[model samples]
Target chain A: MLTRRLSLFATLALSLLLVSGAQAADIVRLATTTSTYNSGLLDYLLPKFEEDHPYQIQVIPVGTGKALRLGRDGDVDLVLTHAPAAEKAFVDADYGVEPHGVMYNDFVIVGPSGDPAAIDGGEDATNAFATLADEGATFISRGDDSGTDKKEKHLWEEADVTPDFKGFRAAGQGMGEVLKMASELQGYTLTDRGTWLAMKDKLDLEIMVEGDTALFNPYQVILVNPQRYDGLNTQGAQALAEWLISDEGQDLIDAFRLKGKALFHASAGEKIDPTSAVHESD
Target chain B: MHELMNTAREALHLLLSFDPALWEIIGVSFRVSLTAILVALPPALLIALLLARVAFPGRWFAISLVNTFMAVPTVVVGLVLFMLLSRSGPLGELRLLFTQRAMIIGQILLAMPVLTAMLHSTLQSIDQRAWETARQLGAGWWQSLWVLIREARFGVIAAVLAAFGRIIAEVGSAVMIGGNIEHFTRTITTAIALETLKGEFAQGLALGLVLLLLALVLNVLLGVMRGRGHQTVSI
Candidate 1:
């Protein structure tokens, strides 16, 4: 009986290996932020790409810090993330190449409808952060070092307020989880407009602050340095990155909307001025 | 290979340095799992005793149901608890979601079936005459039950340890309901999960080492207990 079972196990393992090996070269590993995945943008875009291309894009949704780290480590073929500073650092270190601006979205400070910090409709994210600190209002931070987390730290630094307040919660989780926690605790949090729009109906939180030039979130698609690692599907990565910035990809991004509202503005090949105050065209 | 070696060396250094954050994660794991096992013990024991000793209707069906629940994945448990404790759910008024208490409750649910199934088999393995002898000697029902439990003390302790090991290492429900909040609900497993995602291998490796050491210690204790139980039975 044991011999028979062993033979069956060996056959099963061999079949699994054959199945995976058949499509190994056609797979492109793309590490991206949870914000993009949670906003349902990739879901809308990747199927179209796969329908036309021979490559099957395997998306690894993580925080922006981890996403960029994955690119640096050569663990992924490509990365798509929103943290421009980190992306610049990655490219400067020669860990990545061929960076392209894929799209743009703004961050918003969301809080309970009651607006305990009383900074509703505030244009300055830094001032709103200071008010939250001064009022000792509960704030949920995405302590996971995500793109939004880095932006929140920048805002806190600009406000010159230490985030060691009594009600400051460092939730080492993704954007969606942080938003849910903020709503559950009636706390405030900074989130990308895409994820906020996608999950707004399910959440009780409202947009308390917006339109800050400092809140600009620009996304980039970059390829891992092909020379750094062997066996990387560099061609597949280039194909995906090019498709993301191509006219077809740009149009698809512009047309992808949630609840009849566009979540991302395609900005392929455009020099992005992050501090330029650009309002969302309703 | 060189990078992995350096990470392992750093992990060892971190483990020896007594990092407060690392120890805090360890403490959360033990506190939540220990409380879960302690809370689950009494009810699990009672249910096991009932299934083993009592001949109620559908007794076999209850045993099968418990064994079935043991196969339920930990993430499914987390999803169910997440919904129940969600702000819009029925029990949302308690405000227990994303707290240590919520994690404790999740672990309790995860621990119950394992404890019940293991304890039932332990109680079943006891000599049937032990209970009868205790009762005929003028002991009450509860006293007789205590005697049977004492007769199976080694198995009971082993069951508790095994269940504790299972819950302490569980990351699914803990991550979903606990929210992996730093200085609050970040257990060793959840911390390892987050650190690995963040591409920081040293902390993840250190926490992995802690879990490995714990599994070794628990298994060793279990082996010794089984040996002692064997000797006792033979004697």
Candidate 2:
């Protein structure tokens, strides 16, 4: 009886795998950042993409560095990440095709309600960071070389602060986990606004600083160069790329919201200026 | 075959270099899994003894429940823990999520069922006369319980070893609860997953080889313990 039951379970599991396996053959592998994956954006976007597109998307969420590395290695057919400089470098090196701007979001500095560093009401992210460094305020960095991490590093450089203070921590993980750590420790962190909005209710941390032009973050989708790697799914990559910048995809991205506030602004056809000013007057 | 050779060469280099990053990952894996097993050991043993010796009403059901848990996928355990430890969950106030403590808790949950179920069968296999004889000799409850455990010492050791094997290499719960923070919660398995996703197969393969070596060492220890158990029983 035990053997029979075990076999029955095995058969069920195998059959399920087989069903999914049939669909897996038509899968289009896309390497993306954890921010896009964790904000529940991909979960909302992929189903719509699948309904119209011929290929199924298998989204692998990692750091921006890793995502670009995957593209360079031809491990994935396409890449969707927010690190514009790295994306540009990858395309410039001919590892990937030209990256199309998909959407734009801004980063926010979130911390405890008391706002220990007095960075609140500041439009200058660099100045706020410099003050945090000088005060030795407990700041948690994503530290994973993610797009958010890159922005934080850039802000530190712009602020001319070393960020080597004793209170600074590098939680080398995704954006959501860093948010949780910031809430638990009451430390400050830089995060993409979409993820911040999605998880704000559950966390005690509040947006302490915002509306900085330096905080602007944008996302891009690039097709991995098929010429570099054999067995490359160029057709699937092309189709997905074309569909993303299409009217339908832009509409879907524009329609996505959290807590009645739109998380991202679609910028499919336009060149995104990284230093574009965010709405501070609101 | 060429890829395999290259991976083996890389694995050897990583192992020989005494790489701090790799060692740190190993340290996290050992620290979490060892602490989990130690926390789980006493309770699992006591429960196994109870289910083996006591004439409880729901004893059969209890045994069946334990056996059922043995089949629970690691990912399901991870998902359950993730929800419970997330900022929105009931335990959110504790703020234990994304910490080594949370991963330890998940590993404890995972190890308990395997330890209890395996040790239960070992306890059952011990002769009932061994307990009777201890009692006949005026042995106290604690003394007799110790003797009974000694009788199944090899089996208990094997059970502990098996539990360790199940958890040390588990990725799902570790990644889910621990968040795989580098220099913090990243274990060998989580690191391997990350490296493989990044298309760095050499590092992933090296980590895989280390896991395989760990399993081999554990099996060797189990074999030695079993031999000693046989000698003691014969004498």
Candidate 3:
């Protein structure tokens, strides 16, 4: 009986290996931020991309920092993230190539309906952060070094307030988890508009601040440098990256919506900023 | 290979230097797991004794149920607890979600089945004469129970150690319920999970080493207890 079981297990393992090996040539590993995944953007976009292409894109959703690190370590073929400064550093360091703006969104500060910090309807994110710190209002931070986390830290710095206050919590989690935590704790948190629109119904929080130019979040797709790594799916990576910025891809991004509201603006070929070296079409 | 060596060296440095953040995570793990085990021990022992001694109806069913619960994944437990303690759930008024207390509760539930199953087997293996003789000598029920437990002391200790090992190493429930809040609910396993996600391998490796050392220590203790038990039985 034991011999029979062993043979059965070996056969099963061999079949699994064969199945994976069959598709290994066409696999494109894309590491991206959790916001994009949690917001259900990739779920809507990848299937359409796969319909036309020979490659099957595997999405690994993590914090932006880890996504870029995966690109740097050659663990992934492509990275889609929103932290522009970090993306610039990654490309400048020769870890990634052909950075192109794929889409744009904005971050908003959300808080409980009670508005304990009284930051509701605020246009200035930095000033609102200052108010939250002054009142010692509970604030949940995505401490995972995600794109949203980096933005929150930047706002805190601009507000000239140390986030080490009594009611500040650094939750090392994703955007969805942080939003849920903020609702549960009745705290304030910074979130991208995509995830906020997707999860706002279930959350008891309200958008307290928006429309700040500093809150602009732009996403980019960059290929892992083929020169630094061997065995990379450079062809598939380039295909996906180029396809994302094509007219058809941009149109799909513009059409994708959550709750009957557009979540991301297609910004292919647009300059992220005057200082950024990421324009592909110009 | 070179990067791996550098990370390993950094892990060792973090361990030797006694980094505050690393130690804080270790502290959370011990505090929460210890509280959970302590809270679970007494009821687990009682249930085990009842299952082993009492000839109640559905006794076999009860034993099967416990063994079934023991097989349930930790994440399933976390999911159930998360739903119950969520703001929309029935127990939302208590507001216990995403706290160390909630983690302790999840760990207690996780620890109970293992504790009861192991303890039941240990109590079942004890000679029936030990319980009967104590009672016949006019010792009260509690005293008789105590005598029975004393006879299987090593097995009971082993059961506790084994359960501790299971719960301490479990990451699924702790991450889901504890929320991995820094300096609050972040345990060793959750910290490692977070660090790995953030692409910081040194702290994760350091905590992984701590857990490995803990597993080694528990196994050695179990071995010692087994040897002592054999010596006692031979005598």
Which candidate has the top score in lDDT?
3
DockQ pick, better of 1 and 3: 3
Q: What is the TM-score of each candidate against the true structure?
A: 0.87, 0.77, 0.89
Which clashing pairs does model 3 show?
Answer: none
Lowest lDDT 10-mer window, candidate 3 chain B?
B226-235
Judged by DockQ cut-offs, is candidate 2 incorrect, acceptable, medium or high?
A: incorrect
Best by TM-score: 3
Misplaced by over 4 Å in model 3 are: A1-26, A50-54, A274-282, B132-140
Could you give the DockQ of candidate 2? Answer: 0.19
- Residue B81's C-alpha lDDT in candidate 1? 97
**Which portions of model 2 show Cα errors greater than 4 Å?**
A1-31, A34-62, A99-103, A116-118, A131-140, A159-173, A184-186, A230-282, B1-11, B75-95, B132-140, B194-201, B223-235
Per-model CA lDDT versus the true structure: 0.89, 0.84, 0.90
Number of the top-ranking candidate, with DockQ as the measure: 3
lDDT of 1 at B108: 96
In the range B148-232, model 1's lDDT, one tens digit per residue, is: 9999999899899899999999899999999898888999999998757767789999999999999999999999988887777
lDDT of 3: 0.90
